[model samples]
Target: MTLDVDEIERLYAYPATERPWVRTNFVSTLDGAATGTDGRSGTLGGDTDTRVFALLRSLSDVIVVGAGTARDEAYADYEVDTDLRGRLGLSPIPAMALISRRLDIPQHLLVADNLVVTTADADPARLATLRESVEVIAVGDGEIDWPDVLTIFADRGWTRVLCEGGPSLHGELVAHDLVDELCLTIAPILAAGGAPRISHGAHTVDQQMRLAHAIEADGGLLTRWVRDRDR
Candidate 1:
């Protein structure tokens, strides 16, 4: 079924209150992908998928992205809809959270309520510099601890999080059993050589997910899955 704006909005809106977290992970084909491999995801999906993506971002309290994705996509803070915020019982804008092992971030890219999650052993100077621009959070015991990171977000009242990933980070989350839901958009075109596949994580068939739903968007397939409870 082709997704429409009302359906997209309703899907996101319903999940915001029922689910604690929702992660949207996607990858594009070769031959200059995701908006022509020049590196933009704007053209990757159709109008419906685009609206769905925007709604997903809008309903999230925090948009969690890997540092690599942030750099490659030239990420920026999304303007929040006050009406949506009131409906979801959220503040004006959602926080933009970046997960980076190093402190190598550009000062100009810092958003007003941006956050950097790094290891406790990260360079002091880098931490200080980031503090000058946005919130700097140190989690784990000198490593990027996933458990600690979740606890940190939980402590900060971020129950609903949207992780827009770039493979490696998604693999890490999958490996750690941290992902509760997966929303994948599969384009009709294939990139047999250029970009990597949707997931590179190591998992047995027992780790397979159960399909919750699927929709046709922009001639491609958008599938949602939930981890098998029996697994």
Candidate 2:
């Protein structure tokens, strides 16, 4: 089920619902390693997976990531393609949102376009420094209140949220039952290294999801699963 660029975009379009939609995008090996032996998910993504990933970012209004993933991936300010944005009727640029408890964001990503979602009890000095320029969002005291955070985004018209995770954050989202869709790309190779799974939250919540689409392309399986609203 190989699809061209346009068909891929159409296939992954955000649901036209008023409520906030949290769509997570991740790539894993055939044997279920989130990252390859190189300790990076980028290494496992094939051409089709890469195309779908970029399209997901471009189509969404915001790019959400944890601080570790941002730092590890060396995430910079998100520069979305204007041509793609216009075609998809998306905003000019997808905002970058970093979720961190310590506010340990990189200097390059401290611009106004980037947001730091940190805990309310974060260091005053760090908060003060970020307050001078960036949009600082405080969720909880020690743990993040992801539902509240999503509600805030919904109010801000950032209903189309794209989360590129670092496992822990994805785990938390799953634990809280906040994930609306999961786009998993299964790479062809088998990576048996000590890489973590796609998610790792302490508390577990078993939820059912419906597979919306599955496509085979670029030596990988690109699949989308929509969260089942009914239990």
Candidate 3:
């Protein structure tokens, strides 16, 4: 049951709030693996997930992604549909916010709206080079202070935040109480490899989530889970 653009928007509209509303979107296999054998999450999703993926990007001002995942998933493509964003009245392209501790980003992606979110613990020489090409955001001296990052995003009017995770980053966001929702698509594949789950970190917090809705489409289960604000 593939949905048209309007229905997709109706299903996953960002909450109307002043602060940053964080939502991490991912597609996983039935076996709980977030990727297929080829080491890419894209292989686990189908047409419906692709459509929703586009809508998620079309609705956000910036895409927060781990530098590793950005490289593994070829996010240098920016994965944005500019025309779709235009018709939906969103920014022509969501800024690609690549978080890297070492400041190891591809040279070609070091232009335009590619924001390098890192820390003071990174390599100084590399940071100098990256700063020359794009804006560099360092919110933490030892680690990434996600709360401050959110504040910066809000200050820039990029309140609708979409986190495309490589697990650790998503886990940090969850542990920080910064995530508002998770839009997960369960692909019907039993990937029995060692791919990590959707979110993991050195530390974790147990926050209750409400299963907002689940829709079956394109041989996958599209689910929306919102953080239970009362919890």
User: How well does each candidate superpose onto the true structure, as a TM-score?
Assistant: 0.85, 0.95, 0.94
Q: If ranked by TM-score, best first, what sequence of candidates would result?
A: 2, 3, 1
Candidate 2: C-alpha lDDT: 0.87
Tens digits of per-residue lDDT, candidate 2, 92-169, equal 988889999878888888898888898888899999999898999897879877878888888888989999998999
- Report the number of the highest-TM-score candidate: 2
lDDT of 1 by residue, 105-201 (tens): 6666575678888888888888887887788788776568877777777777787788888666777787777777787766676544455454555
Candidate 2 similarity to native, TM-score: 0.95
lDDT of 3 by residue, 142-226 (tens): 8898888888999988888999998988888887887899999999888887989999988857888999989998788999999
- Residue 37's lDDT in candidate 1: 49
lDDT of 1: 0.70
lDDT score of residue 20 within candidate 1: 42
Candidate 2 Cα errors over 4 Å, as ranges:
none
Clashing pairs in 3: none
